[model samples]
Target: MATLQIDADNFQPTITNNATVIVDFWAPWCAPCRGFAPTFEAAAEKNPGIVFAKVNTEEQQEIATAFNIRSIPTLMIFRDQIVIYSEAGALVPAAFDQLIEQAMALDMDQVRLEIAGQQASS
Candidate 1:
C-alpha cells in the first residue's frame, strides 16, 4: 500500500471511513520529515490494512493548526475515528511498529467508555 497524500479536502472523510489511519504531518524542507518518509512508506506497505497518509503542513496550514502541530514529523494515529496517539518527532521503525501493534490491540469499546466517562464527569 502506498502512502496517500492527504489534504484538507479529504482529511475528514478519510478519518471518518478508515478504521486505522496514521497521519504524518510534515513539510518538504524539514530534514526530519524527509528522513521519516521512507520509514512511513515501508510501514504503509507492511500494514496493508492501515491507511498511511501524509499531510504537508506547508500546504495544509489549516489542518496543521487544527491539530496544534508545532513541529515537523508529527505523527498521529486515529483508530475508530478517535485520536489514540499523537506526538511530535520521528520514530524508529521498531517503535513505530510497536505503536501500530498496540493501537490495533486496543479495545475500542473500552476506549469509548472511558471517553464517555470523562465527558460525563466534565
Candidate 2:
C-alpha cells in the first residue's frame, strides 16, 4: 500500500478501480507538502485497501489544472468514482484519520442517488 506517484496518464485508471482514493496535490518546493508527505505515506501503509496517490503540481501542471488546484498541498478524497471530500492545507494525523473514517462511513448508494438527483435538477 505504498503511495503511488500519479500523473495525468495514470490518474484515471488508478482512481476508478479503487473504492476509496486519497490524492495529495503537492509540489516539491512547498514546505507544508513536504511535511505532509510522511503522514500521507504512513496512512497508505496503514490503510492497504485505499489507494493513496500523489500528483506533483510542479511536474504535472495539466493534472493540477484539471482538478483546479489553487493551493499547494490540497487533499482530495474520492469514493465510488466521485469526489467525496476536498480541502486545502496540511491535515494533522488526527484530522486525516477522521477523514478516512468519514470516507469509510459513507453510504455510496445514497451518495449516488443524491448525485443523480442533482444531475436531474441541473
Candidate 3:
C-alpha cells in the first residue's frame, strides 16, 4: 500500500473525491524528508482505507505555492475535499499516528454547516 504520488497537475483530482488523503510535501535533498519516507510508507500500508500521497516540492513548485508549503516534509490530511489537518516538518511514527487520528476525528459535515451558518449570518 504505497502512498500515491501527487503532482501539480493532479493534486486536485487526488484530493477531490471526498476521501481521507494524506499528502506529504517533500524534497529529495532534505534529510528529514528522506528519513520519514519509510515511516510514511509503513503508515500507508497499515491504513489501506486512507489515500496517502506524496508531493515532491522541487518538482511541483506551483502546487507547493498553492498549499503555502514553506517547509520540507509537510503533511496535509484532507477529508471531504477539505484540509482537516496540516503540519510542517517530519513527524515520528507516534506523531504521525496521532495526526491520522486527528484527521479521522474531524467532522466535515459540521464544518460545512458552520461555514454555511457563518455565511448566512453575514
Candidate 4:
C-alpha cells in the first residue's frame, strides 16, 4: 500500500474513521525524514489493514500544530481517533516494525468503547 498524503482538511475524518491509523509527521527538507521515508513506506506495504498517512509539516501547518509536532519524522498512532502512541525522531526499520506490532497488539475493544463513550457524551 502506498502512503497516503494527509492534510489538515482530511486528517481528522480520516483518523476518526479508521480503526487504526499511523501518521508520519515529516518535512521534505529534513534528511532523517527523507532517509526514513522508504522504511515507512515498507511498513505501510506490510500492513495493508492499517491506514498509513504522511503529513508534510511544511505544507500542513495546521495538522502539525494539532498534533504538537515539534520535530521531523515523528510517528503518531491513533486508534479510534484518540492518539495511542506518539514519538519524536526517525526509527530504523526494525524499531518501526516493533512499534507497528505494539500498536496492533493494543486492546482495540477498549479504544472503540472509549470513542463510543466520547460520542455519547457529546
Top TM-score model: 1
Model 4: CA > 4 A from native: 110-122
Give the alpha-carbon lDDT of every model: 0.96, 0.93, 0.88, 0.90
Cα lDDT of model 2 by residue, 1-122, tens digit: 88999988899998888888999999999999999999999999999999999999999999999989999899999998799998999999988988899899999999999999999999
In model 1, the worst 10-residue window by lDDT is: 1-10
RMSD of every prediction:
0.5, 0.8, 1.6, 3.2
**Best by lDDT, which number?**
1
Q: Write down the TM-score of every candidate.
A: 0.98, 0.97, 0.90, 0.87
> What's the distance in Å from true for residue 4, model 2?
0.1
lDDT of 3 at 88: 91
Residue 102 lDDT (model 2): 87
What's model 1's overall lDDT? 0.96
In each prediction, how many residue pairs overlap at the backbone (N, C-alpha, C within less than 3 A)? 0, 0, 0, 0
Candidate 4: C-alpha lDDT: 0.90
lDDT of 1 at 35: 93
Error of 4 at 60 (Å): 0.5
Please, what are the lDDT tens digits per residue for candidate 3 over residues 48-96? 9999999999999999999899988899888888776788988889989
Off by over 4 Å in 3: 118-122
List the lowest-lDDT window of 10 residues for candidate 4: 106-115
lDDT of 4 by residue, 31-104 (tens): 99999999999999999999999999999998899778898889999976778899999899999999899888
